[model samples]
Target: MSGAAAAAPVRRLAVIGCGLMGGSFARALRARGLLQQAVGVARSAEARARAVALGVVDEATDDPAAAARGADVVLLAVPVAATEATLRALAPALADDALLMDVGSTKADVVAAARAALDAARLARFVPAHPIAGKEKAGVEHACAELYRGAQVIVTPLPETAADAQRRAQALWEAVGARVRTMTPQAHDAALAAVSHLPHLLAFAAVHALAQQPDGARFLELAGPGFRDFTRIAASDPDVWRDILHANAAEVRAQAAAFRAALDAFEAALAEPARLRLLIDEASRVRRAWAPAGAPPSP
Candidate 1:
Protein backbone atom coordinates (compact mmCIF):
# COMPACT_ATOMS: atom_id res chain seq x y z
CA MET A 1 0.00 0.00 0.00
CA SER A 2 1.15 3.53 -0.68
CA GLY A 3 1.37 6.02 2.20
CA ALA A 4 -1.76 7.69 0.87
CA ALA A 5 -3.61 4.40 0.86
CA ALA A 6 -3.28 3.84 4.64
CA ALA A 7 -2.71 7.36 5.93
CA ALA A 8 -4.79 10.47 5.38
CA PRO A 9 -7.50 10.29 2.75
CA VAL A 10 -6.51 10.76 -0.88
CA ARG A 11 -7.12 14.43 -1.73
CA ARG A 12 -9.61 13.95 -4.54
CA LEU A 13 -10.74 11.36 -7.07
CA ALA A 14 -12.13 12.06 -10.52
CA VAL A 15 -14.39 9.49 -12.12
CA ILE A 16 -14.74 9.90 -15.87
CA GLY A 17 -17.90 8.47 -17.49
CA CYS A 18 -19.75 8.12 -14.17
CA GLY A 19 -21.56 4.99 -15.35
CA LEU A 20 -21.91 1.68 -13.54
CA MET A 21 -18.16 0.95 -13.25
CA GLY A 22 -17.06 4.49 -12.39
CA GLY A 23 -20.01 5.11 -10.04
CA SER A 24 -19.45 1.87 -8.15
CA PHE A 25 -15.73 2.67 -7.72
CA ALA A 26 -16.44 6.11 -6.30
CA ARG A 27 -19.11 4.72 -3.99
CA ALA A 28 -16.77 2.02 -2.71
CA LEU A 29 -13.90 4.41 -2.02
CA ARG A 30 -16.20 6.83 -0.24
CA ALA A 31 -17.66 4.02 1.83
CA ARG A 32 -14.14 3.01 2.85
CA GLY A 33 -13.18 6.62 3.74
CA LEU A 34 -10.26 6.40 1.35
CA LEU A 35 -10.85 9.67 -0.45
CA GLN A 36 -11.82 13.22 0.49
CA GLN A 37 -13.74 14.24 -2.62
CA ALA A 38 -15.29 12.55 -5.66
CA VAL A 39 -15.97 14.38 -8.88
CA GLY A 40 -17.62 12.83 -11.88
CA VAL A 41 -17.71 13.57 -15.63
CA ALA A 42 -20.66 12.63 -17.75
CA ARG A 43 -22.35 14.04 -20.83
CA SER A 44 -25.87 13.56 -19.58
CA ALA A 45 -27.28 16.13 -17.18
CA GLU A 46 -29.56 13.53 -15.73
CA ALA A 47 -26.63 11.17 -15.18
CA ARG A 48 -24.61 13.85 -13.41
CA ALA A 49 -27.55 14.73 -11.18
CA ARG A 50 -28.24 11.07 -10.47
CA ALA A 51 -24.61 10.45 -9.55
CA VAL A 52 -24.71 13.17 -6.92
CA ALA A 53 -28.09 12.02 -5.64
CA LEU A 54 -26.91 8.43 -5.33
CA GLY A 55 -23.74 9.48 -3.43
CA VAL A 56 -21.64 8.19 -6.30
CA VAL A 57 -19.98 11.57 -6.45
CA ASP A 58 -19.87 14.79 -4.47
CA GLU A 59 -20.12 16.85 -7.67
CA ALA A 60 -20.45 16.20 -11.37
CA THR A 61 -19.76 18.05 -14.59
CA ASP A 62 -19.80 17.39 -18.31
CA ASP A 63 -16.31 18.75 -18.91
CA PRO A 64 -13.71 16.03 -18.40
CA ALA A 65 -10.93 18.55 -17.69
CA ALA A 66 -12.96 20.33 -15.02
CA ALA A 67 -13.67 17.08 -13.23
CA ALA A 68 -9.96 16.17 -13.23
CA ARG A 69 -8.78 19.44 -11.72
CA GLY A 70 -7.16 18.90 -8.31
CA ALA A 71 -7.74 15.16 -8.46
CA ASP A 72 -5.01 13.10 -6.74
CA VAL A 73 -6.36 10.01 -8.45
CA VAL A 74 -8.46 9.54 -11.57
CA LEU A 75 -10.41 6.54 -12.82
CA LEU A 76 -11.12 6.53 -16.55
CA ALA A 77 -14.13 4.23 -16.81
CA VAL A 78 -15.30 5.06 -20.29
CA PRO A 79 -15.86 2.55 -23.06
CA VAL A 80 -12.69 1.52 -24.93
CA ALA A 81 -13.61 3.62 -27.96
CA ALA A 82 -13.67 6.78 -25.83
CA THR A 83 -10.52 6.11 -23.82
CA GLU A 84 -8.17 8.17 -25.96
CA ALA A 85 -10.51 11.13 -26.22
CA THR A 86 -11.23 11.20 -22.51
CA LEU A 87 -7.54 10.94 -21.64
CA ARG A 88 -6.64 13.68 -24.08
CA ALA A 89 -9.29 15.98 -22.66
CA LEU A 90 -8.22 15.45 -19.04
CA ALA A 91 -4.45 15.21 -19.46
CA PRO A 92 -3.82 18.91 -18.98
CA ALA A 93 -5.98 19.13 -15.88
CA LEU A 94 -4.42 16.26 -13.94
CA ALA A 95 -2.24 17.02 -10.97
CA ASP A 96 1.52 16.43 -11.22
CA ASP A 97 1.35 13.47 -8.87
CA ALA A 98 -2.08 12.14 -9.75
CA LEU A 99 -2.30 8.39 -10.18
CA LEU A 100 -4.46 7.40 -13.14
CA MET A 101 -6.19 4.05 -13.61
CA ASP A 102 -8.96 2.61 -15.74
CA VAL A 103 -11.54 -0.17 -15.67
CA GLY A 104 -11.49 -0.86 -19.40
CA SER A 105 -11.86 -4.50 -20.50
CA THR A 106 -9.20 -4.30 -23.21
CA LYS A 107 -5.69 -3.36 -22.08
CA ALA A 108 -3.54 -3.18 -25.22
CA ASP A 109 -5.79 -0.62 -26.89
CA VAL A 110 -6.11 1.39 -23.69
CA VAL A 111 -2.33 1.50 -23.27
CA ALA A 112 -2.03 2.73 -26.81
CA ALA A 113 -4.55 5.42 -26.05
CA ALA A 114 -2.67 6.52 -22.98
CA ARG A 115 0.54 6.76 -24.95
CA ALA A 116 -1.16 8.87 -27.56
CA ALA A 117 -2.85 11.27 -25.16
CA LEU A 118 -0.63 11.63 -22.12
CA ASP A 119 2.72 13.37 -21.93
CA ALA A 120 5.76 11.61 -20.46
CA ALA A 121 4.85 12.50 -16.88
CA ARG A 122 1.18 11.60 -17.21
CA LEU A 123 1.99 8.42 -19.10
CA ALA A 124 4.30 7.28 -16.30
CA ARG A 125 1.45 7.70 -13.83
CA PHE A 126 -1.00 5.77 -15.95
CA VAL A 127 -1.63 2.20 -14.88
CA PRO A 128 -4.19 0.52 -17.12
CA ALA A 129 -6.59 -1.68 -15.13
CA HIS A 130 -9.54 -3.93 -15.76
CA PRO A 131 -11.91 -4.97 -12.99
CA ILE A 132 -13.72 -8.19 -13.77
CA ALA A 133 -16.87 -6.97 -12.09
CA GLY A 134 -20.26 -5.53 -12.98
CA LYS A 135 -23.94 -6.43 -13.08
CA GLU A 136 -26.50 -6.98 -15.84
CA LYS A 137 -27.98 -3.67 -14.74
CA ALA A 138 -26.46 -0.48 -16.16
CA GLY A 139 -26.20 3.22 -15.12
CA VAL A 140 -25.21 5.04 -11.95
CA GLU A 141 -28.58 4.22 -10.39
CA HIS A 142 -27.39 0.63 -9.96
CA ALA A 143 -24.02 1.59 -8.48
CA CYS A 144 -23.14 0.29 -5.03
CA ALA A 145 -20.10 0.00 -2.75
CA GLU A 146 -20.13 -3.78 -2.91
CA LEU A 147 -19.94 -4.09 -6.68
CA TYR A 148 -16.20 -4.91 -6.59
CA ARG A 149 -16.18 -6.97 -3.45
CA GLY A 150 -14.31 -10.24 -4.02
CA ALA A 151 -13.85 -9.33 -7.67
CA GLN A 152 -10.71 -9.77 -9.77
CA VAL A 153 -8.84 -6.68 -10.99
CA ILE A 154 -5.96 -6.82 -13.50
CA VAL A 155 -3.42 -4.02 -13.82
CA THR A 156 -1.05 -3.73 -16.76
CA PRO A 157 1.92 -1.49 -16.09
CA LEU A 158 3.79 0.25 -18.88
CA PRO A 159 7.58 0.12 -19.06
CA GLU A 160 7.92 3.66 -17.76
CA THR A 161 5.28 3.50 -15.05
CA ALA A 162 6.07 5.25 -11.79
CA ALA A 163 6.43 3.20 -8.61
CA ASP A 164 4.09 5.32 -6.55
CA ALA A 165 1.40 5.22 -9.22
CA GLN A 166 1.54 1.42 -9.35
CA ARG A 167 1.34 1.11 -5.58
CA ARG A 168 -1.54 3.56 -5.32
CA ALA A 169 -3.52 1.78 -8.04
CA GLN A 170 -3.23 -1.64 -6.36
CA ALA A 171 -3.95 -0.22 -2.89
CA LEU A 172 -7.05 1.51 -4.19
CA TRP A 173 -8.46 -1.74 -5.55
CA GLU A 174 -7.47 -3.58 -2.37
CA ALA A 175 -9.25 -0.98 -0.28
CA VAL A 176 -12.39 -1.80 -2.25
CA GLY A 177 -12.05 -5.56 -1.46
CA ALA A 178 -10.82 -6.68 -4.87
CA ARG A 179 -8.10 -9.23 -5.59
CA VAL A 180 -5.50 -7.74 -7.92
CA ARG A 181 -3.21 -9.41 -10.45
CA THR A 182 -0.54 -8.18 -12.85
CA MET A 183 -0.23 -8.95 -16.57
CA THR A 184 1.34 -7.44 -19.66
CA PRO A 185 -1.08 -5.48 -21.82
CA GLN A 186 -0.86 -7.83 -24.77
CA ALA A 187 -1.17 -10.89 -22.56
CA HIS A 188 -4.22 -9.47 -20.86
CA ASP A 189 -5.91 -8.72 -24.17
CA ALA A 190 -5.20 -12.14 -25.66
CA ALA A 191 -6.44 -14.06 -22.60
CA LEU A 192 -9.56 -11.97 -22.17
CA ALA A 193 -10.30 -12.30 -25.90
CA ALA A 194 -10.37 -16.05 -25.51
CA VAL A 195 -12.37 -16.34 -22.29
CA SER A 196 -14.40 -13.16 -21.93
CA HIS A 197 -14.71 -11.73 -25.44
CA LEU A 198 -15.25 -15.06 -27.14
CA PRO A 199 -17.93 -16.16 -24.69
CA HIS A 200 -19.80 -12.86 -24.97
CA LEU A 201 -19.68 -13.00 -28.78
CA LEU A 202 -21.07 -16.53 -28.71
CA ALA A 203 -23.86 -15.49 -26.36
CA PHE A 204 -24.90 -12.57 -28.52
CA ALA A 205 -24.74 -14.62 -31.72
CA ALA A 206 -26.69 -17.53 -30.23
CA VAL A 207 -29.50 -15.25 -29.16
CA HIS A 208 -29.45 -13.53 -32.53
CA ALA A 209 -29.70 -16.86 -34.31
CA LEU A 210 -32.68 -17.88 -32.23
CA ALA A 211 -34.38 -14.55 -32.78
CA GLN A 212 -33.95 -14.85 -36.55
CA GLN A 213 -35.98 -18.05 -36.69
CA PRO A 214 -39.61 -17.99 -37.95
CA ASP A 215 -40.95 -18.90 -34.51
CA GLY A 216 -38.28 -16.82 -32.77
CA ALA A 217 -40.63 -15.11 -30.32
CA ARG A 218 -42.39 -18.37 -29.45
CA PHE A 219 -39.11 -20.21 -29.10
CA LEU A 220 -37.77 -17.55 -26.74
CA GLU A 221 -40.96 -17.65 -24.75
CA LEU A 222 -40.59 -21.42 -24.29
CA ALA A 223 -36.82 -21.29 -23.59
CA GLY A 224 -35.70 -23.14 -20.45
CA PRO A 225 -33.08 -22.41 -17.81
CA GLY A 226 -30.34 -23.81 -20.04
CA PHE A 227 -31.07 -21.38 -22.86
CA ARG A 228 -31.49 -18.44 -20.51
CA ASP A 229 -28.23 -19.20 -18.74
CA PHE A 230 -26.27 -19.53 -21.96
CA THR A 231 -27.68 -16.31 -23.37
CA ARG A 232 -27.44 -14.17 -20.23
CA ILE A 233 -24.44 -12.16 -21.51
CA ALA A 234 -26.44 -11.24 -24.61
CA ALA A 235 -28.31 -8.86 -22.34
CA SER A 236 -25.16 -6.73 -21.98
CA ASP A 237 -25.43 -3.14 -23.19
CA PRO A 238 -25.27 -3.26 -26.98
CA ASP A 239 -23.45 0.02 -27.45
CA VAL A 240 -20.82 -0.99 -24.93
CA TRP A 241 -20.47 -4.43 -26.51
CA ARG A 242 -20.23 -2.87 -29.96
CA ASP A 243 -17.27 -0.76 -28.92
CA ILE A 244 -15.60 -3.68 -27.18
CA LEU A 245 -16.10 -6.15 -30.01
CA HIS A 246 -14.81 -3.67 -32.53
CA ALA A 247 -11.86 -2.59 -30.39
CA ASN A 248 -10.69 -6.19 -30.07
CA ALA A 249 -11.97 -7.33 -33.43
CA ALA A 250 -8.89 -9.30 -34.47
CA GLU A 251 -8.73 -11.46 -31.35
CA VAL A 252 -12.50 -11.93 -31.26
CA ARG A 253 -12.52 -12.96 -34.89
CA ALA A 254 -9.73 -15.47 -34.33
CA GLN A 255 -11.64 -16.97 -31.44
CA ALA A 256 -14.75 -17.16 -33.58
CA ALA A 257 -12.80 -19.02 -36.25
CA ALA A 258 -11.58 -21.46 -33.61
CA PHE A 259 -15.15 -22.02 -32.48
CA ARG A 260 -16.20 -22.73 -36.06
CA ALA A 261 -13.52 -25.40 -36.39
CA ALA A 262 -14.72 -27.04 -33.17
CA LEU A 263 -18.27 -26.97 -34.43
CA ASP A 264 -17.17 -28.53 -37.71
CA ALA A 265 -15.54 -31.39 -35.83
CA PHE A 266 -18.74 -32.00 -33.87
CA GLU A 267 -20.80 -32.04 -37.09
CA ALA A 268 -18.42 -34.44 -38.78
CA ALA A 269 -18.60 -36.83 -35.82
CA LEU A 270 -22.42 -36.85 -35.85
CA ALA A 271 -22.51 -39.88 -38.17
CA GLU A 272 -20.52 -41.93 -35.63
CA PRO A 273 -22.44 -42.21 -32.38
CA ALA A 274 -19.38 -43.47 -30.47
CA ARG A 275 -17.23 -40.51 -31.62
CA LEU A 276 -19.97 -38.02 -30.81
CA ARG A 277 -20.40 -39.51 -27.34
CA LEU A 278 -16.63 -39.36 -26.78
CA LEU A 279 -16.52 -35.69 -27.78
CA ILE A 280 -19.41 -34.81 -25.45
CA ASP A 281 -17.78 -36.77 -22.65
CA GLU A 282 -14.53 -34.86 -23.13
CA ALA A 283 -16.32 -31.53 -22.90
CA SER A 284 -18.18 -32.64 -19.79
CA ARG A 285 -14.91 -33.62 -18.14
CA VAL A 286 -13.39 -30.18 -18.82
CA ARG A 287 -16.43 -28.46 -17.32
CA ARG A 288 -16.59 -30.75 -14.33
CA ALA A 289 -12.93 -30.25 -13.51
CA TRP A 290 -13.16 -26.52 -13.80
CA ALA A 291 -14.02 -24.28 -10.86
CA PRO A 292 -14.32 -20.52 -10.91
CA ALA A 293 -11.93 -18.71 -8.61
CA GLY A 294 -12.97 -16.15 -6.02
CA ALA A 295 -14.47 -13.93 -8.68
CA PRO A 296 -13.18 -14.13 -12.27
CA PRO A 297 -12.49 -17.82 -12.81
CA SER A 298 -8.81 -17.45 -11.72
CA PRO A 299 -8.04 -14.75 -14.28
Candidate 2:
Protein backbone atom coordinates (compact mmCIF):
# COMPACT_ATOMS: atom_id res chain seq x y z
CA MET A 1 0.00 0.00 0.00
CA SER A 2 1.11 3.58 -0.56
CA GLY A 3 2.24 5.41 2.63
CA ALA A 4 -0.93 7.48 2.74
CA ALA A 5 -3.15 4.47 2.09
CA ALA A 6 -1.31 2.43 4.70
CA ALA A 7 -2.06 4.99 7.41
CA ALA A 8 -5.80 5.16 7.73
CA PRO A 9 -7.08 7.68 10.24
CA VAL A 10 -7.26 6.46 13.83
CA ARG A 11 -10.88 6.64 14.96
CA ARG A 12 -10.32 5.48 18.50
CA LEU A 13 -7.22 5.06 20.66
CA ALA A 14 -6.55 3.20 23.89
CA VAL A 15 -3.80 4.38 26.17
CA ILE A 16 -2.69 1.69 28.68
CA GLY A 17 -1.04 3.98 31.21
CA CYS A 18 -2.43 7.34 32.36
CA GLY A 19 0.93 8.69 33.48
CA LEU A 20 2.76 11.67 31.94
CA MET A 21 3.63 10.25 28.53
CA GLY A 22 0.29 8.51 28.05
CA GLY A 23 -1.65 11.53 29.23
CA SER A 24 0.33 13.79 26.95
CA PHE A 25 -0.25 11.49 23.98
CA ALA A 26 -4.00 11.48 24.61
CA ARG A 27 -4.12 15.25 24.96
CA ALA A 28 -2.07 15.71 21.81
CA LEU A 29 -4.35 13.37 19.89
CA ARG A 30 -7.38 15.32 21.03
CA ALA A 31 -5.81 18.67 20.18
CA ARG A 32 -5.12 17.49 16.64
CA GLY A 33 -8.53 15.87 16.21
CA LEU A 34 -6.84 12.61 15.35
CA LEU A 35 -9.03 10.31 17.42
CA GLN A 36 -12.81 10.17 17.51
CA GLN A 37 -12.51 8.93 21.07
CA ALA A 38 -9.77 7.83 23.47
CA VAL A 39 -9.92 5.33 26.31
CA GLY A 40 -7.49 5.05 29.18
CA VAL A 41 -6.43 2.12 31.37
CA ALA A 42 -4.76 2.56 34.70
CA ARG A 43 -4.02 0.03 37.42
CA SER A 44 -5.65 2.04 40.19
CA ALA A 45 -9.11 3.47 40.56
CA GLU A 46 -7.61 6.81 41.59
CA ALA A 47 -5.51 6.92 38.42
CA ARG A 48 -8.50 6.07 36.27
CA ALA A 49 -10.56 8.75 37.95
CA ARG A 50 -7.79 11.29 37.47
CA ALA A 51 -7.39 10.46 33.81
CA VAL A 52 -11.08 10.96 33.18
CA ALA A 53 -11.14 14.13 35.28
CA LEU A 54 -8.19 15.50 33.30
CA GLY A 55 -10.13 14.80 30.11
CA VAL A 56 -7.13 12.99 28.68
CA VAL A 57 -9.43 10.25 27.51
CA ASP A 58 -13.13 9.95 26.77
CA GLU A 59 -13.36 6.95 29.11
CA ALA A 60 -11.14 5.62 31.87
CA THR A 61 -11.17 2.12 33.28
CA ASP A 62 -9.04 0.06 35.58
CA ASP A 63 -9.50 -2.96 33.33
CA PRO A 64 -7.01 -3.02 30.45
CA ALA A 65 -9.19 -5.39 28.44
CA ALA A 66 -12.21 -3.12 28.63
CA ALA A 67 -10.17 -0.07 27.68
CA ALA A 68 -8.49 -1.80 24.72
CA ARG A 69 -11.64 -3.33 23.24
CA GLY A 70 -12.40 -2.04 19.73
CA ALA A 71 -9.55 0.46 19.81
CA ASP A 72 -8.09 1.35 16.40
CA VAL A 73 -4.76 1.95 18.12
CA VAL A 74 -3.39 0.84 21.48
CA LEU A 75 -0.47 2.81 22.93
CA LEU A 76 1.35 1.02 25.73
CA ALA A 77 2.68 3.75 28.04
CA VAL A 78 3.27 1.79 31.21
CA PRO A 79 6.72 1.26 32.72
CA VAL A 80 8.91 -1.13 30.74
CA ALA A 81 8.81 -3.69 33.56
CA ALA A 82 5.01 -3.65 33.52
CA THR A 83 4.71 -3.83 29.71
CA GLU A 84 4.45 -7.63 29.43
CA ALA A 85 1.74 -7.85 32.06
CA THR A 86 -0.21 -5.00 30.49
CA LEU A 87 0.05 -6.54 27.03
CA ARG A 88 -1.13 -9.89 28.34
CA ALA A 89 -4.11 -8.31 30.02
CA LEU A 90 -5.11 -6.39 26.90
CA ALA A 91 -4.38 -9.14 24.37
CA PRO A 92 -7.81 -10.75 24.52
CA ALA A 93 -9.57 -7.42 24.12
CA LEU A 94 -7.46 -5.94 21.35
CA ALA A 95 -9.07 -5.65 17.92
CA ASP A 96 -7.66 -8.17 15.44
CA ASP A 97 -6.48 -5.40 13.12
CA ALA A 98 -5.58 -2.79 15.77
CA LEU A 99 -2.17 -1.13 15.66
CA LEU A 100 -0.24 -1.74 18.89
CA MET A 101 2.60 0.56 19.82
CA ASP A 102 4.61 1.63 22.89
CA VAL A 103 6.58 4.61 24.26
CA GLY A 104 9.10 2.74 26.38
CA SER A 105 12.72 4.00 26.48
CA THR A 106 14.31 0.64 25.75
CA LYS A 107 13.15 -1.53 22.84
CA ALA A 108 14.76 -5.01 22.69
CA ASP A 109 13.24 -6.31 25.91
CA VAL A 110 9.82 -4.75 25.36
CA VAL A 111 9.67 -6.07 21.78
CA ALA A 112 10.56 -9.56 23.02
CA ALA A 113 7.97 -9.42 25.77
CA ALA A 114 5.33 -8.23 23.30
CA ARG A 115 6.13 -11.16 21.00
CA ALA A 116 5.66 -13.57 23.88
CA ALA A 117 2.54 -11.98 25.36
CA LEU A 118 0.55 -10.99 22.27
CA ASP A 119 -1.29 -13.52 20.11
CA ALA A 120 0.74 -14.78 17.15
CA ALA A 121 -1.97 -13.75 14.70
CA ARG A 122 -1.84 -10.14 15.95
CA LEU A 123 1.97 -9.91 16.00
CA ALA A 124 2.04 -8.13 12.63
CA ARG A 125 0.02 -5.27 14.11
CA PHE A 126 2.58 -4.50 16.81
CA VAL A 127 4.73 -1.47 15.98
CA PRO A 128 7.32 -0.80 18.66
CA ALA A 129 7.90 2.96 19.17
CA HIS A 130 9.83 5.35 21.41
CA PRO A 131 9.40 9.12 21.41
CA ILE A 132 12.63 10.96 22.10
CA ALA A 133 11.04 13.75 24.08
CA GLY A 134 10.03 14.30 27.72
CA LYS A 135 10.74 16.54 30.63
CA GLU A 136 12.37 15.43 33.86
CA LYS A 137 9.12 16.07 35.68
CA ALA A 138 6.55 13.29 35.22
CA GLY A 139 3.01 12.33 36.24
CA VAL A 140 -0.27 13.49 34.67
CA GLU A 141 -0.05 16.83 36.47
CA HIS A 142 3.06 17.68 34.42
CA ALA A 143 1.69 16.42 31.13
CA CYS A 144 0.93 18.87 28.32
CA ALA A 145 -0.45 18.45 24.82
CA GLU A 146 2.49 20.28 23.28
CA LEU A 147 5.13 18.10 24.93
CA TYR A 148 5.98 16.29 21.71
CA ARG A 149 6.09 19.24 19.31
CA GLY A 150 8.99 18.89 16.87
CA ALA A 151 10.34 15.86 18.72
CA GLN A 152 12.03 12.93 17.02
CA VAL A 153 10.04 9.71 17.42
CA ILE A 154 11.82 6.43 16.71
CA VAL A 155 9.79 3.60 15.19
CA THR A 156 11.24 0.09 15.43
CA PRO A 157 9.50 -2.43 13.23
CA LEU A 158 10.16 -6.10 13.85
CA PRO A 159 10.12 -8.87 11.23
CA GLU A 160 6.53 -9.60 12.11
CA THR A 161 5.44 -5.96 11.94
CA ALA A 162 3.08 -5.26 9.04
CA ALA A 163 3.66 -2.30 6.71
CA ASP A 164 0.21 -0.93 7.42
CA ALA A 165 0.73 -1.15 11.17
CA GLN A 166 4.05 0.68 10.91
CA ARG A 167 2.51 3.39 8.77
CA ARG A 168 -0.37 3.86 11.17
CA ALA A 169 2.02 4.08 14.08
CA GLN A 170 4.06 6.74 12.32
CA ALA A 171 0.95 8.73 11.48
CA LEU A 172 -0.19 8.56 15.10
CA TRP A 173 2.99 10.25 16.31
CA GLU A 174 3.04 12.67 13.39
CA ALA A 175 -0.47 13.71 14.25
CA VAL A 176 0.94 14.91 17.56
CA GLY A 177 3.52 17.03 15.68
CA ALA A 178 6.50 14.72 16.00
CA ARG A 179 8.99 13.79 13.25
CA VAL A 180 9.09 10.01 12.94
CA ARG A 181 12.27 8.12 12.05
CA THR A 182 12.78 4.41 11.55
CA MET A 183 15.57 2.47 13.24
CA THR A 184 16.52 -1.12 14.01
CA PRO A 185 15.76 -2.22 17.56
CA GLN A 186 19.48 -2.72 18.22
CA ALA A 187 20.49 0.67 16.82
CA HIS A 188 17.72 2.48 18.69
CA ASP A 189 18.68 0.90 22.00
CA ALA A 190 22.41 1.50 21.56
CA ALA A 191 21.97 5.13 20.45
CA LEU A 192 19.61 5.91 23.30
CA ALA A 193 22.04 4.38 25.81
CA ALA A 194 24.64 6.96 24.84
CA VAL A 195 22.47 10.04 24.20
CA SER A 196 19.56 9.52 26.59
CA HIS A 197 20.01 6.80 29.25
CA LEU A 198 23.65 7.59 30.04
CA PRO A 199 22.95 11.30 30.52
CA HIS A 200 20.10 10.50 32.91
CA LEU A 201 22.36 8.20 34.93
CA LEU A 202 25.09 10.81 35.08
CA ALA A 203 22.65 13.53 36.09
CA PHE A 204 21.28 11.34 38.87
CA ALA A 205 24.78 10.44 40.00
CA ALA A 206 25.92 14.05 39.94
CA VAL A 207 22.99 15.21 42.03
CA HIS A 208 23.45 12.31 44.46
CA ALA A 209 27.20 12.82 44.80
CA LEU A 210 26.75 16.54 45.38
CA ALA A 211 24.07 15.97 47.97
CA GLN A 212 26.41 13.70 49.91
CA GLN A 213 28.99 16.48 50.39
CA PRO A 214 29.18 18.09 53.83
CA ASP A 215 28.39 21.54 52.47
CA GLY A 216 26.00 20.30 49.78
CA ALA A 217 23.03 22.30 51.01
CA ARG A 218 25.05 25.52 50.95
CA PHE A 219 26.52 24.63 47.57
CA LEU A 220 23.08 23.98 46.18
CA GLU A 221 21.82 27.29 47.53
CA LEU A 222 24.53 29.00 45.48
CA ALA A 223 24.00 26.86 42.39
CA GLY A 224 23.16 28.87 39.29
CA PRO A 225 21.34 28.05 36.05
CA GLY A 226 24.11 25.71 34.94
CA PHE A 227 23.61 23.36 37.85
CA ARG A 228 19.84 23.37 37.45
CA ASP A 229 20.09 22.65 33.73
CA PHE A 230 22.57 19.84 34.23
CA THR A 231 20.54 18.19 36.99
CA ARG A 232 17.13 18.60 35.32
CA ILE A 233 16.87 15.00 34.02
CA ALA A 234 17.86 13.70 37.44
CA ALA A 235 14.38 14.67 38.60
CA SER A 236 12.82 12.05 36.31
CA ASP A 237 10.94 9.15 37.93
CA PRO A 238 13.40 6.78 39.57
CA ASP A 239 11.19 3.76 39.03
CA VAL A 240 11.03 4.46 35.28
CA TRP A 241 14.77 5.03 34.96
CA ARG A 242 15.51 1.86 36.94
CA ASP A 243 13.43 -0.16 34.50
CA ILE A 244 15.09 1.50 31.49
CA LEU A 245 18.62 0.92 32.83
CA HIS A 246 18.03 -2.71 33.69
CA ALA A 247 16.11 -3.42 30.49
CA ASN A 248 19.10 -2.26 28.42
CA ALA A 249 21.79 -3.30 30.88
CA ALA A 250 24.51 -4.32 28.41
CA GLU A 251 24.39 -1.10 26.37
CA VAL A 252 24.04 1.05 29.47
CA ARG A 253 27.03 -0.68 31.09
CA ALA A 254 29.19 -0.04 28.04
CA GLN A 255 28.06 3.59 27.91
CA ALA A 256 28.89 4.02 31.59
CA ALA A 257 32.40 2.65 30.99
CA ALA A 258 32.98 5.04 28.12
CA PHE A 259 31.71 7.97 30.19
CA ARG A 260 34.01 7.05 33.05
CA ALA A 261 37.00 6.94 30.71
CA ALA A 262 36.13 10.41 29.41
CA LEU A 263 35.82 11.71 32.97
CA ASP A 264 39.25 10.23 33.80
CA ALA A 265 40.79 11.93 30.82
CA PHE A 266 39.35 15.29 31.90
CA GLU A 267 40.57 14.74 35.45
CA ALA A 268 44.09 13.96 34.23
CA ALA A 269 44.06 17.10 32.12
CA LEU A 270 43.27 19.22 35.22
CA ALA A 271 46.83 18.61 36.50
CA GLU A 272 48.35 20.08 33.33
CA PRO A 273 47.56 23.77 32.90
CA ALA A 274 48.00 23.82 29.12
CA ARG A 275 45.97 20.65 28.60
CA LEU A 276 43.19 21.93 30.89
CA ARG A 277 43.01 25.24 29.01
CA LEU A 278 43.00 23.44 25.66
CA LEU A 279 40.17 21.08 26.75
CA ILE A 280 38.04 23.93 28.14
CA ASP A 281 38.52 26.13 25.07
CA GLU A 282 37.76 23.31 22.65
CA ALA A 283 34.60 22.30 24.55
CA SER A 284 33.34 25.89 24.71
CA ARG A 285 33.94 26.50 21.00
CA VAL A 286 32.19 23.26 19.97
CA ARG A 287 29.24 23.84 22.26
CA ARG A 288 28.76 27.43 21.10
CA ALA A 289 29.00 26.44 17.47
CA TRP A 290 26.48 23.61 17.79
CA ALA A 291 23.95 25.37 20.03
CA PRO A 292 20.60 25.91 18.37
CA ALA A 293 19.68 29.42 17.26
CA GLY A 294 16.30 30.87 18.30
CA ALA A 295 16.18 28.31 21.11
CA PRO A 296 14.48 29.45 24.26
CA PRO A 297 16.98 31.13 26.53
CA SER A 298 18.23 28.64 29.12
CA PRO A 299 17.01 29.48 32.58
Local distance difference test values of all predictions, in order: 0.87, 0.85
Expressed as tens digits, the lDDT of each residue in 11-47 for candidate 2 is: 8889888889988998887776666888988878887
TM-score of 2: 0.93
Q: Which ten residues in a row have the lowest lDDT in candidate 2?
A: 290-299
- Tens digit of lDDT per residue, candidate 1, span 1-299? 23225534667889999999999998888887886899999899999999998888999999999989999989998889999999989999998789899999998889999999999999999999999888667799989888888888999999999988898788888888788899998888888899889999999889899899999999888889898778878889887788888988899889889989999999999999999999999999999987655563432
lDDT value, residue 210 of candidate 2:
94
Distance from true position, residue 120, model 2, in Å? 2.3
Candidate 1 versus the native: TM-score? 0.94
The top-ranked prediction according to lDDT is 1
- In candidate 2, which residue pairs clash? none
TM-score on alpha carbons, each prediction = 0.94, 0.93
Candidate 1 stretches with Cα past 4 Å from truth are 1-8, 296-299
What does the lDDT come to for candidate 2?
0.85
